[model samples]
Target: MNEFKKTNIENPVVVIGGGASGMIAAWRAASLGVPTLLIEKNKKLGIKILISGGGKCNITHDGNIEDLLKSFQKNEALFLKPSVYKFNNRSILKLLEERGVETYTRDDGKIFPKSNDASDVIAALEWYLRNAGVEIRTDCSVQEIIFENNCVTGVKLNNEIIYSSNVILATGGVSYPQTGTTGDGFRFIEKTGHTIVPLRPALAPIKLSNKFPYGWGGVAIRDAELICLVNNRKTHSERGDFLFTHEGISGPTVLELSKYAAMELANNKVELILDTQPDKDATMLDSEIQQLIGLHPNKQIGNIAGLFLPNRLVNHFLNSINIDPEKECRKLIKEERKQLVKLIKEMFIGTIDTIDITKGEVSAGGISLKEVDPKTMQSRLVKGLYFCGEVLDIAGRIGGYNLQAAYSTGFTAGESAAINYKSQSTTP
Candidate 1:
């Protein structure tokens, strides 16, 4: 049991994980004049941040904090209310701005660095931690957290024991194993009397059971509704733009609804129904198609359909319903026209095969929020222990909400822990 001497403080505040939340937590703790140490198993910090938003890093969402809270579920929003309000999107942006990183918000309210580089975000965070005198230990994996009598003492590594009264576990969930987030925090906390919500994949792509032979990999559908139907009844649905992958489909809408769809896929048969023309009903679309057919009687039916649907999907759409794409509009019968209308309104994509959690942008499920104090992000079951970021069972939809959660929760935990440490140190 060797004591680590990386910091001058008698008992430094130790933070595990070097991702978004961990970095912020260490910075905040050290900023309060508390010596802090950030430990990461990987060779570098913010590996996950570098790959987020396709390397652009959607830093946070812009708008009112209340509106931003609406992006998460009711319980999650309630749990995050205090922390998020304390360190909201504006708070995070101000920190980054002070660190020499300029950012801009998209029309849809997703904020990103002006450089359009994720490395800039990481660099700013690193600069903040360094200037604040936070000691970071990379390439060091925490084997276990040492606690006795329901109080956290510190963490145990391969050959060293770092002693600290306060330990913040900001380790992320089980997603993108390549980034080093392999559910280690879940394991560490579970052994310490924390209840973990079963982990699942969030913001992941869904693989389709129906394999379309055609290469529709790059084809995109705009303003379409993707509905998850179990036994022919609608269970969940979302509306936005989605792109066709070689094996399946992925986009904002699909990624947002993936959490629900993945849950429904366990027992029931799940099918994805795409409403390509959601704005118009079958009757309205049929009338428009009839008018087009009447005006161009000599034109091929497939060519006419191209005006309504993507040209690349026209032939497949016609063939799936047993309609001849080359048939002239004048020769089309009433039944065939109705079939075209039905297919146009609700195109059957296919049943869901599986949603791989490893490919998810964020993993759902973690340490139960009920076991943690929302006001301080301290564990209710264990003294001197704290949690933040994806380690909590709160996951928001795509578009900067999750990142904002990380920053807010981390700040709350760090501030609270540092204050608690100060009070304890001065106690008689």
Candidate 2:
């Protein structure tokens, strides 16, 4: 255990929220020799962390800094560059490993605890906070941020005011309400004079308007590309595994493009074009179909289609193109073969019905980045005030990107706040 420096500061550096960012922020602040207090509205800390990556807890991604930065949008990447470079994936994993939490990275670059238990991740974070001499308050909701003349004084919990010159708001976004994230941080920041970007669902599943009328639920398509088109023009596209759900289409590819699909669906004709065999063009697929027909002249057309498509889809695909699946391959017409090739190349799934933010993996908007200093995560308008984690307008693609952002920003905010507090205490 490292020794904390003795200080005479009256008020401690208070960190609100007990999720990924808040825990790291509190631990970083307290470890820096400044007294720190962490507040959580939930019954316990790290509720969200416990449920991250379906309870396995994706700690971060495995890659160099530049490659990871490219995973996010240009502006968000630029803002995150400093903090991410400072703390980074290797840094967090090293911290976890030090706390006895062994981790491994997936082939896709997602890093998770070797124990495969999210509880261990939470235990490690909690242990860090405790050993760093940080006081933690759970089941306490901060009602307001107490500020005077555009400077944060502290936070108000219930009727009591907790005074602190430095406050870090790591309250997260409105996604996963059951996990305790419900946009509470937004209200707190807005009251203190900050512009909030309108919230939207990012990394959300796409609900189809037709609602899976084809009875294709539970069907999985591999190596497929989903293209989102509005007004017959391509808007966005993603390539990955796609799944048919009871109400809509989901899986990695759909979630990646759902944000754009939701935005385009608001005021246009939105359609999803699925390329099942992206590697094959119309001519190439048609040539393959001809070769199959010649090889098995006596085989049923449906049986021939099964050679290229899933058995479950053979009948439906052939029927949709006005082809008799029962007909022998030798009797198949050229036009019918072309139709099959066309559908195989570019198949229309359905229009998007809804993309609910509540069901999203992350909310895309929060306190506008313009008013927050990316370098330190401190509010430019409010001294002694800082924001980090999902509360800021930064969302990344699926994988371990979001968690890394939380940790990186949290570290920056905590270190900056602690150093600022120390500087203020020593000034004559």
Candidate 3:
């Protein structure tokens, strides 16, 4: 550890929320010899990190800066470059591996611990902090930000007050309330005279209009294309694993497009079309269907369709085409075949509503990117105040992009906040 020769050691730099971003900011600052105090509302830090990647803890995507930067909100990426590339996925991955948390990359290039456990990731982050001399306070909620003459003096928590020279808010967004993302940080920012963009649910499941969605629950659609259309115009689409739940369809592909779907569904009826075989042309599919009918002329159309889709969808597909389940494959008329072909190509699933923000992987919209210094992450409105993690308007696509943003911005804020704190002290 660098001798925290800042001489402001008595005051310390307080970082709020000890999740992924908060952990990095606190650890980075403390490691550099700046007295750091990390406040966590949860009993322990990295609670969300422990459940990330379905317990495997996807650390980061194996993508270069160009690709990774493209995954984030456009305006926020401009501010993220300085931090993300400064201490990127490779750096974080390497640091954890050094601590014996060996990681392996998935087929999709997402990095996870070799043991595929999220607890290990949390263990490493906690260990890094303890070794770096960072003081951690848990079960403490930040009531408000204390400011004197437009400068951060400290944070108000419960009955007492904690003072600090530099303040970093890494408290995260309103998503995942159980994991401790209370969104109190947004309130705190607003109380301090900052602007917060309207929050929306992103990376969440899209509720379906199938009124009987529970009928298809537990069905899995693989390699299927999910297309969201608003007022007859295709808006967003994704292709991957889609799982049927009691409420709606979810998974990587659906979650990635849910934000766009929610936006469209907000104003009008949105159609979520599922194409079972997007690669096959209409004629090719028609020809294939003809062969199936010819080969199973005596077989029920419901039974024949089961060979292609989920077993639970057999009767549903038949009814959708206005055909009886017991109807023979050969009984399908020419016009009906054409209609079914159209349905096959553009199989529509009505999206009645959207999942709650509470179920989101991350909440989009936070401190507007315009109010922040892209180079150092210091808030322009509040000179010594810095923002990082999901608290900023930088939510990214699924995969490890969110975690990467946290590490990048946290590192940048920790470094810049330390330097700025030292510079201000010397002037007096």
Q: Which candidate is the best by lDDT?
A: 1
lDDT of 1 by residue, 1-428 (tens): 56654432446689999999999999999999999999999999999999988999999999998999999999999999999989999998999999889999899999999999999999999999999999999999998888899999888888777888899998898889989998888888776778898888889988887876558987888998888899999988899997888767888888987899888888989988888888998899999999999999999999998977789989988998998899999999999999988887778888889998888989998999999999999999889999999989998988999999999999999999999999998899
Residue 27, candidate 2: C-alpha displacement in angstroms: 0.7
**Which residue pairs in model 2 clash with each other?**
none
Assess every candidate by TM-score: 0.94, 0.93, 0.90
Q: Please, what is the whole-model Cα lDDT of each candidate in the order they appear?
A: 0.90, 0.88, 0.83
- Cα TM-score of candidate 1: 0.94
In model 1, what are the clashing residue pairs, if there are any?
none
Clashing residue pairs, backbone N/CA/C < 3 A, model 3: 4-33
| Number of clashing pairs per prediction, in order | 0, 0, 1
After superposing candidate 1, which stretches have Cα over 4 Å from the reference? Answer: 1-10, 294-298
Compared with the true structure, what per-residue lDDT tens digits does model 3 show for residues 1-428?
32322232346688999988889888888888888889999988899888888888888989788788888766777778878879988899988988999988888878888999999888998999999999999988988887888888888776767777689999898888999898888888776678898888888767765655467877888888888888888887888877777766777878988777776666788878887777888899888988999998999877766765677886887687887878888898888778777776787777657567878889888898888897888888886899889999877988899998988898888887778767776887
For model 2, the local distance difference test gives: 0.88
